[model samples]
Target: MDPLGALQEPLFTVLETPVSWTEVLGFGSGALCVWLVARQHLANWAVGIANNLLFILLFTDAGLYADAGLQIVFIALACFGWWSWTHGGGPADRLPVRRTARHEWAWLLAAGAAGCAGLTLLLDRATDSTVPQWDALTTVLSLMATYGQCRKLVESWWIWIAADLVYIPLYAYKELYLTSLLYVGFLALCAAGLRSWRRDLVARIAVTA
Candidate 1:
């Protein structure tokens, strides 16, 4: 097996060294879903849709509204992404990694900012959650990151990597240290994605050159 895969093998536990069976199962499902996503299999999104449901409940119980809500959106986008990658981009077209277009980047930033404001106001008013604003900011950015991933944008990994780095501490603060480690794994996966996708992009350029 590849070194990256080997490294991930040891991290398949849940909730500290003690390892809860429930967390292990959830983490395993989530990991399998991500592996499929990395392989560009359309079925990944289906697995992800299921994983999102599980995570929605997990995050909701943890008081992570932004994450819970984002999971719902992920379900919608995962379906859209699965369809688009298969049919929208041309019946036989391959999903290729590409740099983010200027307009697309602008849209992501604007959407993130708008999402922060909107979520902050709504969460603040709707509940007594302490970190509603932070929750919204992270959620919006994470939404953009996931959307970027669905499109196979090279920069999506960067956005996700950044977001996950921030999320590590945030999850820890919420006493979900196990989930924090999961974000760490996500950060590593994002870096791996950057490398793998860059290789793909360079190969394409080399062939065209």
Candidate 2:
């Protein structure tokens, strides 16, 4: 009868796995958040923030400190993305999807490399994370994808796809099977997002042409 313990208690059994409230809510909110993002809806940020909070609790309980910490970062990024979509649109005040620039790609790649290296070292030294390298890799990819999404860069979907691929196996190894299944859904949503965003970008280009 502790409150936190009650919250973490099993909601039901999924394939003999005790599914908790955090995982179930995280799964639902995560799916909705990504679906909204794929549809270019502003509410995705709000839903995504809620999902991050739940994952923070879920990851911490699972001893995935790196992912737990990443959820905090995700909250901040979601706020910035919210403001960006509302205010960063030039003149029209409506952000439109665009392609990543050549120079921007170089910087993003460099950031990914440095972030992965630094986070891997920190997680390996500071925490008992068994999958530090893979965790760090996915963390960096998620960061890149979030930044790209905030900027409305169509390439964000590619980065998301890469992260989802890593996340599926990583979560499965961590015994977070529900979260693993969620990432499988994310992979499909990301493909749809890529196709949709690319269509928007092409339409914009044609309008200017």
- On TM-score, the candidate that comes out on top is 2
Task: Write candidate 1's Cα lDDT for 1-209 as tens digits.
Answer: 76423333444433454333334445666667666666666788877887787677667767888788888999999888887677645326766777899999998898888888999999999976778877887888789988998788989888887788778888777766676777777777677768888898898879879
TM-scores for the candidates: 0.84, 0.96
Give RMSD to native, each candidate: 7.0, 1.2
Task: Point out where model 1 deviates above 4 Å.
Answer: 1-23, 88-91
Q: By TM-score, how accurate is candidate 1?
A: 0.84
lDDT of each: 0.75, 0.92
